[model samples]
Target: MNRLTTACLLTPALLAAPACALDPQPVNIQGLQFYPSLLLGERYDDNYREAAYAAPSSWITTLEPRLRLVAEDRNSAYRLTYAGAQQTYHDDSSASHLDHRLLLEGILEFTARHRLTLKAGYSRLEETASTAIPGVNDEYSLRTFGATYRFGAETARNNLEFAANHERLRFHDDSLVNAREERDASRLGVTWFHRIGGTRALIETRYEDFDYVQPDSPLNSHNLALLTGAVWEASAKTSGRIRAGYQRKEYDDDGRDGLESPMWEIGLDWEPRSYSRFSLTTRQAYDEGDDGADAIKQTRTRLDWRHEWSERLSSTLFVGAARLRYQGLDREDDLSSAGLTLTYQPRRWLELALGYSHWDNDSTVDRERFQRNLYTLTATGSL
Candidate 1:
C-alpha cells in the first residue's frame, strides 16, 4: 500500500531521532545551500493488505530521493523541498506505485516584531482502496497554502499570532470504477502567549469549514475548537508541550447528527543521561470516515525510548495503542503496534538501519480484524 511520507517520516509507533545522525555537508550554489540525499530499502511484510484470511506475503523494494534548497540572510529565509518515493513489489506488481511531493516555505522578518511565515505545498498521493476493492488503488492530488503573522519580538512579554490555511483535494477518475471525489477546507485561527521564565502559557481558538463537491453531502461541516496549553523547558533535561481543549463539529444539513469531544495532545521528553532519552506522546481527535461511517473518534498514545550503545551504534524501541469509535455505525476498533530499530553510522556519509514492526487490529466487525509483521533493512547516503 502507498503511504504518505516526507524526508523524515514518523510512523504510528516509531519516532525519528535525527540527533543521532551526523549531518551531511551541503553544497552552495547561487547563494543557496543544496542538499541531495537518497534512501534504498528492502521490506518483507507477511500481511501487506491486513486481510484476516488468505494473507499474502511479499518482498518489496523501496527507493526515495530528496532535494532541498535553503537560503537565509539577516532579514529573511527561504526554503524549497522535494521528495519522492517508489515502491515495487516482487509478488504483486499491481501494488507498485510512485508518489511525489513539493513544498515551498519562507519567513520574512519585516522588522523583527512584525514577522510573517508563508508555505505552500502540493502532493500526488496513491492509496490502496478500502476492503471492498482491495486490489485497486485510488489516486488523488492535494494542494495546500498557509500563512502566519507574529506581532511580538524576542524580548516581548506578550505575543499574538494570527494564522490562516486553505486546502483542496481532488481524486483522479481515469478508470470506469473510479468516481471523482473532491473537497475544500479553509481555516482561520489566532493565539495569545504569555511568557513567564522558561515556560509559556497559551490560549488559541480556531474555526474551520469543510465543503464537499457532492450536492448536499452530509460530509460538509463546520468545526470550532478552543485550546489552552503550555510549552515549557523545565531544565536542561526536560521539555515538551501540552494542549487540551474542546472541539465541536456541526453538519450543514440538520438531518445528520453532529459530534462533540474533548481534544488533547501531549508530548513530553526526558533525558536521565546524555546517552539515553525517553518520549511520551498522546492525542485525541476526530477524523473523517468512509464506508457508511460518518466520522471516527480516535485516541492514540505512544512511548519511545532511544539508547546509544556506543558512539556509532544506537537502538530505539516504540510502542503505541489506539482506539477508534465509529459514528453513525455500530463499529469500534482497538489497535496495538510496536517497533524496534537498530541503527549504525559507520561513516559520515552513510547510515544503515534494521527494523521490525508488528501491528494488530481488533474490531467489532470480524472482517476488519488483522495482524501484520514487517521486517526491513534500509541504507541512506549522500554524495
Candidate 2:
C-alpha cells in the first residue's frame, strides 16, 4: 500500500476517464495555420543487421510528407515544420533511404511573465550501427535559444522561475564516427513553486555545459543538478510530473573518470475509462556516446496504453525498458521493447494503421546481441 499510497488511491479512478482524440485538426488560412500530412507505409524487418550472427531480413517501402505551420497572436508564437521521407528496400538495397526534416519554432511573450524561446533544426538521417561499426548517413544542425522569467502574480502562492538556455550541435560527417560529434550545450535554471492543495511543489537547480569538437574529446562535460518535484492535477482526471535528483558529471579528461549519479524524471497520466488511457515514463540519464563510448549511463522505462473501441476503432499499447552503462567501457546493455498499434479512423481526414514490434538486445558484447521484429502497414491523409 505504498507507491504513494497506490497513487493516492488511484486518483479518483484516473480522473474519471475520457480524453483522447489524438491531435490533428488544423487547417486555416488568412490567420495562417495548417497541417498537411500524407504517409503510406509498409515495413517488415526480422532483423536487419543488429546481428549476433547471420541476420538480415527486410522489406520496406515508405513515403511520407508532412508539414505544419502556425502563427499566433496576442503575445507571439510561430512554428514551421516539414518532414520528408522515402525509403525502399526490398532485398535491403543497401538499406535505401532519403529523409529530411526542417523545423523552426518560436515564442515570445514579452510580459505576462516574460518569455522567449526559439529553435531551429535541420536533419537528414539514416543510421544503424550499434556497434559493429558500419552504417551512416547523418547530417545534423540545431540551434536553440531561450529565456524565461516569472515570479509571483496571476494567483500566486509563491512561484518563481528563471531559465537560460543555449544549444548548438552540428555534424556533417566528420569521417565516419571518429570525430563528427560537434557540440555545445548550455543551461542554467532555477525554479521554485509551492502551492500544495491540488499540488505543485517544485524545486530545481541546474547547470550544464558541454563543449566539444574533438578537443581531444573524451566528450568534455560538466553537469550539476538538484531537483525535487511534484505536480498533480486531479480534476483533470490525473496528471503527473515527478523528479528526484542529484547528478554530477565532470570530465576534462585525465583518462576519464567522473560521475556521481542518482537522477530521475518520471511522468504518469491516466484516464481509467471513457475509452481508456494510461501512460507512465521514467528516465535516469547521462548520455553522449554512440559506440565510441566514453559516456552513457542510461535507464529508461515506459508504458503506454490507449483504447477507443468505437467511432472508428483504435488501440495502442507499448512497453519498454533499457539500461546501458559504459563510461570508459566495461560495457553493458539491455533493452527490451514491445508494441502494438491498430487504428482506423474512417473519416475526419482518414487514417489506417497496423503495427507490431518487438526488439531485444542483451549485450556484454557479442556482436552486440540482437533480436528484432517489426511489421507495419499504414495509410494516412489530411490536407
Candidate 3:
C-alpha cells in the first residue's frame, strides 16, 4: 500500500492509546488529539518561455494530516506528534510529480525546579519533478533529526531553552545516473527570558554549520553562522525584537576561497485590542557563493493583520515583499504578494476557511505573476 493508505489505517490505533488511559478517571482523555487540515486551491501564472520550468495551471488539491498527543502524570510526561502532507501538481502540462513531507516528534517532560523537557524529532521530505526526456523524472529527498531541551519557571523571573538540530539531504534522479551528494546542517540555539518590574525581556543566540560533500565532483564546503537577538515587551500592546548575525564560508571546490557575510532582522508584534493583532517584520541577509562566484544580498519585509468580527466570522490580511540583488551578474529581482483569509467557526469542533493570494515578480531577467484562490470546508467531531 501507499503512504496515504498506511496513515489512514494507523489513525485508529493512535487514538485509542492515549496517555490518560492509565488513570482511573481517564483524566478527560486530554493527552492525544488528531486533527487534519485539508487544503484545496487553484493557481494560475502567466509567462513561461522555458520548457524546463514547471508552470502551474488553475486547479489543485492538497491533503495534510496533523496529530498531537500529550501524556502526563504527577512527576513525568511524554508526548508524540506527527504530520504528513502531500501536494500533486496538476500543472499546465499534467506531466509533473508530487511533493510529500513527513514529520515526527517525541518529547519527555521531567518534574524539576526549572521544569526541564527533552525532545527528539525526525522529518523527511521528498519531491518528484519532470525531466527533459518524457517519462523520466527527477527525485530529491531530505532527512533530518534534532533534539531540544526547554526549561521554564512557574512564578520566578527566569526561563531557559536550548536546542540542537542536524539535517541531511540526499538527491537522486533517473535523469542523472551518478548524481548523488550529501548535505549536512547543524544548528544550536539558546534563549533566556527574564522578568523585571513587570517588564519582560528575552535574549537569544544561535550558531549553525552547513557542510556539503560530493565524491563525484570532488567538492567539499562548509558554512558557519552566528546570530544574536533580543526582545523586549514595553507594554501590553507593543513588543519588538532585533537580531544581527555573521557567516563565514569555506570551500575546497575548484579553487574557491573563503568568504564572510552579515545579516540583520527587525520584527514587531502588537495587539491593538482583544480582537485585533498586527505584526511587521523585515530582514536583510547576505550569502557567500561557492566555486568563486559572487555573493548574493536579499531583503524581505512583511505586514500581517488579523481581525475578529464576531463569533462565527473572522478575517485576516497579510502583505509580503522581497527584493534580491546579485553581485557580478548585475541582476535585480523583486516580489510583492498579498493574502486574505476568512474563517468561520460556528461550533467548537467545526471550522471553514476561505483564502485568496496574489503574487507578482519583477526582475531584469524575467517577469512573472500568479494568483491563487482556495476554499476549504472542514468538519471535525469526536467522542
Candidate 4:
C-alpha cells in the first residue's frame, strides 16, 4: 500500500492504545515543535568531460520542519519531519532547469524501551527540462518492525537490533518499470566505557549485513560490509580513534566484474587550550576487481581546527587532500578541498552559520581541469 493509506490506517488505532501513551501536553495549533534550519547556498562546478562535475553554477535553498506530539500516558511517542529543497543549475551552457524536492516522514514509537516503531514516508522530485538524467524520483515507501535486546554487564551490555526495510524506487522515464528493494539488516555491536588515569574512554564495534531484493529477471546485486572501530582517551582534553572496514559490491545485470574494497584509518586529537582544538587523520584504501591485477588505490589526509572566541562566536577550518590512482590510467588526479565555518549562537537553542568551500581536480583525461566553489548560510533553532 501507499504511504498515505498506511499512515491513515495505523495512526489512529496506534494513538488510541492505552497501554503505551506519553505524558499529556498542550498541542500547538501550528504543529511546530521545532525548526532545524533555513539554508541557502550557491555552487559552481566546471569540467564535466573528465571528472565527476555534473553541473555548473547552481543556486540552492532548503527548509526542514520538525514536530512532535506527546500523549497523556507514558507509552507512545509521535514525531513528524518534513524537508523541502530546490536547485537551479546550468547544464552544457544551454540546457538549464530547476529541480525541486518535497519529503514527508512520520514515526510512531510505542512500548518505550521495546519501542515498536512504524514509519511512513514519501518524496517527490521533479526537474523542469531533464528527462533522462534522474529527473524525478516519485513514490518511495518504507515499512519497518524492530525491537532491541539488552543484556546485563556480566555477559554483554549492548543494544542489539534487527530491522527489515522495504523500499520502492519509481523512475520518471518508465513509470511501469518500477524497482522494489528490500533489505534485512542487523547489527551486532558492543560498547564499553572505562576510566583510567582520571579520564573516561568509550569503544564500539559493529558488523552488519545488507541484503537486497531483486525481481525474477535478476536485475540487481547485494553484498555485506564489515565495520570495526575503536576510540581511546588518555586525558581530559585528548582522544583518538582507529577504524578498519571492508565492503564487497556485485552487480548481476551490469555484466561487470564485482568489486571489493578495504579501508583503514587512524587519527589523533588534541585540545591544547580551552578555546581551540585540533585533529589530524590519515586514511588508505584499495579497490580491487575479481582480477587481482586490476586495482585502484586511494590515500586521504586531513586536518581540522576549531576555535571559540567567546560564548557567542566560534569558527572552524578544515583542509583535506586525496590522491587516487586507477589501473591502466597513466595520469593521476589530485583532489584538494578546504573550508571554513563561522557560527554565531546568541542563544542556547538557536544558531547561525556561514560556510565556504573550494575544490580543485586536475584530471589526466585530455588534461581536463575542474574546479568548484561553494558558499552556504544556515540558521537553525529548536524549542
- Write down the RMSD of all candidates, one decimal each: 3.4, 20.4, 7.7, 9.7
Model 2: lDDT to the true structure:
0.72
Candidate 3 C-alpha lDDT tens digits along 62-107: 5555455556566655556665655444553343345554545444
> Residue-pair clashes per candidate, as listed?
0, 1, 0, 6
TM-score of 2: 0.32
Give the C-alpha miss distance for residue 279 in model 2, angstroms: 1.3
* CA deviation > 4 Å runs, candidate 3: 1-56, 74-78, 86-100, 106-138, 150-161, 172-182, 190-205, 216-219, 252-254, 286-296, 325-331, 367-383
Which candidate leads the pack in TM-score?
1
Better of 3 and 4 by lDDT: 3
Predicted candidate 4 versus true structure: per-residue lDDT over 1-383, tens digit per residue: 12222222233332342211112233455544332333444444343222343543444444544333433234444544444554444444233323333223333333333334345445454432212233332333333332333222222333333333333433343433233323233334444434444343445444433343434433244544555665667776888887777766555547656666776777989999988999999876543211112335667888999999987888899999987665534656687989998888777656678888877776665433467667777766554
As for model 3, its CA RMSD to the true structure in angstroms is 7.7
Please state the error at residue 220 of candidate 1 in Å: 0.5
lDDT score, candidate 1, position 91:
94
The digit string of per-residue lDDT tens for model 1 on 1-383 reads: 11111211341111112333856778999888887889899999898877788887799998989777888899888788777999888999987889898888888988969989888888887664343356666677888888899999966889899999888876674542222236678889999988999888999998988887777777899889999999889998999999899999999999877899999989999999999999999988776554456677889999999999998899999999999888888889899999999999999888899999999999998978899999999998875
Model 4: ten consecutive residues of lowest lDDT: 17-26
Q: lDDT, candidate 3, residue 185?
A: 64
TM-score of each: 0.92, 0.32, 0.70, 0.55
The residue pairs that clash in candidate 3, if any, are none
State how far residue 322 of model 3 sits from its true place (Å): 1.3
